[model samples]
Target chain A: MSEPVVATDMRKLAATQLFALIGFTVREARNKWTLLALFTLTTLFLFALATLVSIDVVEGSIASARLFGTIPLEIGNTTIPVSDAVTVIQVAIVSLLTTFGLVLALFVTGNIVPLTLQTGWVDLLASQPLGRTVLIIGRALGAVAVVAVTFAYLFGGSWSVLTWKTGFGNAGFLVAGMIILFTFLCCYSGMVLVGVLTRNSPISIIAGVGTWFMGLILYPLHTYAEWTTAFDPGWKRSLASGIAETLYWVLPKSLELTENATRATKGDALAWTPFLASMPFAIVCIALACWWFSRQDY
Target chain B: MNVIETRDLAKTFGGALGSKVEALRGVDLQVGAGEAFGLLGPNGAGKTTLVKILLGLVGASDGDATLLGHRAGTPISRLEVGYMPERRHYPGFLTAGQVLDLFGKLLGMDATLRRQRIDLVLEEVEMSSWRNQKVGGFSKGMQQRLALAQALLPDPRVLFLDEPTEGIDPLGRVSIRGILRRNLEQGKTLFVNSHMLGEVELLCDRVAILVKGKIRREGPLSSLRAPNPEYRLTIAGSDEDAARAALAAAGQEAESVPAPPGLTVWRLEVGDRSELNNVLDATRSAGLEIEEVQRVRASLEEVFVQTINEADDDKAGAGGPGGVQTSAKGATEVSVATREVDNV
Candidate 1:
C-alpha cells in the first residue's frame, strides 16, 4: 500500500511539471495577443485586399491576353497562353506578396518583450521536474505554431479570393500556398531561433529584423560588387559568385515566393528542381536554430 | 535517517582580479524529520547561499548533499521539496487562480486535480474573491501570500522558505505561520531562513545561528535560552554606595555599575533560576526595598548576539577558545562531522 501510494505521488508530480512547462507558452500567447493578433490580421487583410484587386484586373483585361506576358507555352499536349490575364493578376499578387514578405520580416524581428517574458517563464518552469530540453522544444514549437497560423490566415484568405475570381479552380493554388507558407515558416522560425538563443526580447527583435534588412540590402550590394569585382575572380571565385547569385534560394528573399506564385499563375511549367535546391540552406538554418534553442539554458 | 544532509559543503566566489571570497566554508548539516529548523544569520552571512545549495539551484564548490535520499538537483529530490525564495518574482499576467494552477501543474497535477487544488489553495490563501484578478495588480502583501500558495501547491514533504514573511503584514505573517504550523502538524519538515529572530523564536524547534558562512551555534531554543539568572538592582540616594559596602561586608560579590545619572546598578550573577528570589530577598532585608529587581531570560536576540560575538572572539584569538559553546541536537552531529573532515 505504501509503495502504491508513492508511485501515485510520483506520477502526479510528473504530470504537474509537464503541464506547467507547456502552459508557459499559452500564457505568453495570451499576454501579447494585441501584437500577435494585429500582425496576423494585418497580414491577412493586405493579402485578401490584394487578391480582390487582382481578380478585378483579371476580369477587366481577360480579352487583351496578348499585351500582358501571357505568351503561349506548350507542355506536352496542352497549350495555354494564359499570360495577359495571368500577368495582370500576377502584378498585383506580386505586390501583395512583397508586402507579405515585409510584414513577415517585421513581425518576426520586431518587439522582443514576448520573448523576454517567455525566458523568465522558462526559468520558473525549469526548476520543476520537467526536462529542460523538453521545455525549450515546447517553446520553439509554440512559436512555430503562432507563425504558422499567421501565415495560414494571410495566404489562405488571399488564395480563396484568387480562386473565386479566376473561375478556374486549379489544384495548383493549394500547392502554391503551401510553398509560400513553408518559406515563411523557415524565415520566421529562424527569427524565433534568434529570440530563443538571446532570451532577450529587444535583442532578439533587433537581431531578427537586422538580419531581414541585411538580406534585403546586402544581397543587392553583393550582386553589384560581384559584377564589378569579376576581374579578381578565378573559377573557384566564379563558382562562389555563382552560388551567391542564387541567394534568393539560399536565403528567405520573399522574391522566390513571388516568382513562384507568378510562374504558377501563368500556367508556366513549374520545375521542382530550383525549389528543392534552395531547401538545403533553409534546412541548415532551421537546424542551427533548433540546435541552439535545444541546448539553451531555460 | 536524516531528511536532509550535506557533507563538506563549501562555496567560494571569484571576486575582482580573481580574489577568492569564500561564501560557505565546509557547512555540514543534518536536519531530522519533522523538525522546524531555523537558519539564523545577519546580512552577507551566506544563509541564502546555503539554502540555495540545498535547493539544488546553486552548486557547491566542494561537497555533496542529499534530499530525501536522492541526490540534490534530481527530480526525485525536487519532488518532495518546495521553496519560497527570498527574492521572488512571479509572472504578472496570471490570475491568482491561474498562478496557483500553474505551479500545481508544475508539480505534475492533472486538470481535475489541479482545478480542485487551485480552488482549495485560493481559498486557503483567502484570495478566492480575487481568484480572477491578475497578480500584477496584487499588492506586495498579496504577492507574498500568493508565493506561499505556490510553495504549498505540492504539499511537499520538506519545505524551504527563505524570508517567507519578509514583505507580509502582521496578519499576513500570522496566516503564514498558521499555514506552516498546519504543515508541521502534518509531519512536514521545514527549514526556515529569516533575520526575524522573534518569529524564529516562536516557531522554530531548533535553530542554527549562522555567521560569515559558518554555523556558529545551533540547538533547541529552550536549551540556548536557558536563563543566565543575572539579576540587576537600582537603588536610590547614597544607598548605592552603602549597598556596595554592605555587599563587601556580607562577603557577597556585587558590582555597583554606573547606569543612568540619578541611578546606579548592582549586578549579581546567580547560578540558577531558584537562586534569583534568594538574592532579591537578601537585598531587600539589607535595609533596601530594592527599587527594581528583575531576572531576565536570554532572548533569542541576545543568544544570536552572543553567538556572533563568540565567533568574532574565536576569529580574533585564532586558537584560544574561551566562550560559551551553545549547540543543540543536530549541532552535535555537525561538530562530529567537522572533526572527521579535519582529521581527513
Candidate 2:
C-alpha cells in the first residue's frame, strides 16, 4: 500500500548523509557566530601584519626587515638569506597558529559531538539510513571542516604575506598546515570521546585542551625521563620509565607535533616516534567514542 | 504483513547504585500496513521509550522489534521510516527550507529532488509562506509543523509521530488531524503516540493503551469501546419530575445528558431489552412522551482514565513493580506493568 520510500541505495545514503552532516554543522556554526568570530579575528591579524611589516630583498639571497618604517628587525645578522628568513617566518607562523588557534577553535567546535548527539537532533539523525560510524565520523569531520576553513584563511594569509613581502615562496609552509590539522584532530578526538560519554560541552573542551596540555607537558617529561632511564638509580629509572612510556604512548604528542610543524618549515623529515604514536591516539579515541555512541541509550 | 511488530520486547534502564528502571516489560504488538495505530499512555508510561527503541536512538535491553518487517533500528529499516520526536528541537540557525534541504539530503535525495520535495513538504505543513524564515524566530507551533514536514519528506512507508500536535493551536490541531487522515487514506502506516484522546479517537483505526510499560488494552477502536448497556432517551419536553417518577416506578433512574432544542435527553442503564421496554411502558402511562432512544458509549478519554485507575489498583495490590528506587524523581512506581499482555 505504501511506497518502499524510494529504497535508498545503502552506500549512496551514507555518502549523502556524510555531506549533509557537514553542511548542517556549517549552518549551525554560522548561527552560533563562531565562524564569524574566526573570520573577523583572522582578518584583523592579517590586516595588521600586512600594514606594519615590510621585507626588502636583494638578489633573493639577503633581506632587511623593518616594522612600520621605524624599527629594524633583529637576528644573528643585519641581512639574512631570503630562504633562511622564510624558514624563520614559517616556524613563527606555524607555532603561533597552533597555539592560539588550538584554544579558540577547540573552544568553539567542542560542541560538535554533543550537538550532533543532542536530544531532539539525535532522534532524527540516528534514525536515518546511515551507520553509527558514519554519523560520528561525519560530525567530527564537519567540525574539522569548519576549523579547516579558518586554518586555511589565517595560515594561508600569513604565508602569502611573508612570500609577497620577501618575494620568495615557501610551499613547505603550507604542509605545516597538515601538522596543525592532525594536532587538532587528536585533541578533537578526545573531546569527541568525552562528549559521547558525558554530553557536556565544557567538559568536552576540558578533555580536548587538557589532553593537548598533557601532550605539551608529557613530550618534554618523556624526553628527560628517557634520559633518566639510562642515568638514574635502577628503581627510580624503572618507575620513571614505566610512567613515561605509558603516558607518552597513551596521549597525543601535540608539542612534538608542533616541532614537526616547525620541521615542515625547513622541509625536514618528521619525527616518526611522536607522529606515529599520535595517529593511533586519535584513531583509538574516536573509535572508542563511536563504539560507545552506537551502544548509547539516548 | 505487519509493518511494525515487537516480539516479547523489553527495555531496562540502569540507574545509579545498581538500581534499574524497567522501562518496558515483555510486550508484544503488531500493526498492519495502512493502519492508523495510536499508542496511548500517561506520562512516564514507556510510550516515548518504545518509539526511541524502534528508531535505534535507544538500544533495547532485551527481545527485539521490527519496522516494515525489517529488524528495528537498522539502516535498512529506517530507509522507509519517518519519525517525529516528542521534542521539536532543530538547529535554530537553519531556515525552514534549509532544514528540509538537509533532511532531504540525508534521505539521499539529489539536488533537484531535494528542491522539489522541500517545496512540496513546505506546502504540506502549511510552511510554504515561511520557507525562508529562520527557525529561531518561529513560534513553537510553527516548529512543530516544520518537524512534521521533515518526517513527511521522504514519503516514508511508516510514520512514527510522538505528540504530533503538542504546541499547535485548536485550528492548527484540526489541520494536522486532517493531514494525518489523508496520509492514512494514501495507505501509509501511522504509529501515533499521544495524550490527546480526542485526536486519537479521530485519527486511529486501532490503538494500544500502555501503562507503566505494558500494553493493557489493544484492538480496533470500535471493539475497544463497545456499545454500552446504557441508553439515552429524548423526552418530548423538559419534565424531569414526571420522567423521574415514571422511571423510578420501573425500578430505574435517569441522568440528564445535554441535547439540542426540541427534546431533553435522559440516560439510564438497563439490565436487558425487557427492562428497556418496561421503562418505555411506564413513561407512556405517566403521560410522558419518549421521542427517541440511543445507546450510550464511553469516550476514549474516559476509557483511558478508567484503564489507568485500574492499573493503579492492580499495581497497589501486587505490591508495585521491581527495581524502583524511591529517590528517583517523578518516576513511575511500577517498573513492569505486566509480564503477560492480553489484547482481550
Candidate 3:
C-alpha cells in the first residue's frame, strides 16, 4: 500500500509537469480574449440551431420539416431516397464544421508558440528543469487540448440539436470530429514549426493556411493526373503528374482526411492510407520544431 | 566545490554572413559555494550571455560550464538552480500565486511542496498581499519582486540574478538586498550580473569586471581597490617650506600644493609603508608638525572604470581587427590563472 501511494504521487507529479503547458496556453488565450470569443460563438451557434429548425418523424422516418415553420422541406422526391438526403446533409454538415473548425482553431491558437518564445518568458521557462523537447511537445499538445475542448462543445451541441429535431443521429459524427481534429493537428504542426523558427504569429498562420491549401490542390490534381488516360502521354504531362504526386505525398492530406471522416459518417468502406501517411508527416513536423527550438539560444 | 564553474567558455554569434560577433571569448570563471559573486560589465560585455549559458538557456559555442558539479545545459545542472532574468515578465493572465505554482510545477515540485514554497516565497518578497493580483496590472517593481519570488520558490541551491533591482524604487532595492542577504545567510550561492557598482560593492564577496567579452580584473572586492602607495600630509601654514625641504633632504620627492584656509598640504609618493613612516619621522625631526596623514584608496566604481579603460587601451595598442583576438588571448590566460589561485 505504501508503494502504491508513492507511485500515485509520482504519477501525479509527472502529469502536472507534462500538462503545465496546457495551463499556460489556456491562461494566455484567456488573456488575449480568444477563449471568450470561441465560447461565445459556440453558444450563439447552438442557440440558433436549437431555435431555427423544426422536424417531425412518421413511420420511423423523417416525414416533414420546416425552416422556422415557414419553408417546407422534402426528401425522397421520386428518384432520390430519404437515406440519400440524410447522407447529403451529414456530409454537408461534416464538411462545413470541419473546415470552419480548422480555420478557427488555427487563427485563435497560432500565436501560442511565438508568445512562448518571447524573451523574458522563454528565458524563465528554459531555466526550468524541463527539457526543451518536452516544452515544445507539451505546448503543441496544449494547443490541441484547447481545440479539442472547443470542438467537443460545438459538435456535441450540434449533435444534440439535430438528433432531437430529426430523430436521426449517428455516433460516427463524433469520430468525424476527431478526424477533423487530426487534420487540424497536421496543419498546426506546421504552424508550430514556423512559429518556433521565426517567432512570428502571422507568418506561422500564413504558412499553416498555405500548407492546407497546397494539400487541397495537390491531392485532387494527383488523382486527376492518375485517372486521365484521355490525355496524350506527353513528357510535359507526365512531368506535371509526377510533381503533383510528389507534393501530394510530401504535404499533409487535409482533404483526404476530411473525406475519410465523411465516408465514416455514411458507413462506407474507408481508406485510411492517407490518414496513416499524414500522421507520420505531422509527427515529423513537430519533431523538427522541437529540434529547432532545442538548438536555439533564447 | 565551486557552485558555478566555467573553463574556456566561448560563444560567438552571427558569423554566417561574414560579420562575426563574439559574445564571450574563452571566459574562465568560478564561484564558490555560499558566496555572493558579482559579474560587472558595460553593455555588450557578455554578462547576460554568460548568465544565459550558465542557466542552460543557451548553448556555448565552445568550452565547459557546470553548476553544482553537473555539466551546464544538462537537466540535472538546472534542477537545483534558479534564475531571475533582467526585465522578466510573467504571463500577464496569471495571478501571482498561479505563476509561482506553475514555475514550481515546472521544477517538479509536488503540489504540497509547491503550496508551502509559494507561501514562503511570497512572504519573503513581501508580496503576500498581492498573491491573487493579475501580473498584467503589476508595476515594474512589483513584477521584479514577483520574479524574485519565483526564483526563490524552488529553494534553489544557487541563484543567478541579472539586474534584479533594475526598476525597483530605492526602498524596494533595500528590501530586495535584504532578501538576498537572507538567502546568502541560508547558504545559497548567488551570481549577480549588474552594472550597479554600489550594490555590487555592498553585496559581493568578490567580483569580476568583463569588458568586450574578456575579464579585465577579478578578485575579492577589498583587493580590487587597494590603497595607492601615496600619502597626503597637512602642516601648519608657516611650516610649509621646512616640510618640503625636510622631505627633499630625505631623498623623497615631495610637492607642496594649495591648502584650504590656514593649512599647508604636501603630496608625497613612497615606495612602501616603511618609506611613508620615514617621511613622517623626517618631518617631525625638522620641527614641522604634521597635522593629518591621509592615504587615498580607489572606490569600486573607479576601479571598474579604470579596468575597462585599460582593456580599451590594450585593444587599441594591439591594432586593427586582430586587436580583439590578441586581447582575448591574454585575458583568457589571466582568467585561468585567477581561477586556479582562487581554487587553492
Best by DockQ: 2
Q: Tens digit of lDDT per residue, candidate 3, span A1-298?
A: 0111111243454466678887777666766576788789889978887877666666556667678778887655434334455556667778886677688789888988988898888988888877788888888888898888888997788778777766667777778888888888999999999999999999999988877878888787877656545556788667767777877897889888888889877877778887888887788899899989999988
Preferred candidate (TM-score higher): 2 or 3: 3
Instruction: List runs of model 3 lying over 4 Å from the truth.
Output: A1-15, A66-89, A164-167, A226-239, B227-229, B249-251, B255-257, B268-273, B316-344
lDDT of 2: 0.81
Error of 3 at A140 (Å): 0.6
Q: What lDDT score belongs to each candidate, Candidate 1 first? A: 0.63, 0.81, 0.79
lDDT of 2 by residue, A36-134 (tens): 977998899888878887777788766566789679876546657888877886788788878987878899899888888788888778877778988
Clashing pairs in 2: none
Instruction: Tell me how many clashing residue pairs each candidate has.
Output: 11, 0, 0
DockQ of each: 0.22, 0.62, 0.45
What is the iRMSD in Å for candidate 1?
4.7
Runs in model 1 lying further than 4 Å from the true structure: A1-23, A33-123, A164-199, A211-298, B15-20, B227-295, B310-344
* Ten contiguous residues minimizing lDDT sum, candidate 2 chain B: B335-344
Please, what is the TM-score per model? 0.72, 0.86, 0.89
Candidate maximizing TM-score: 3
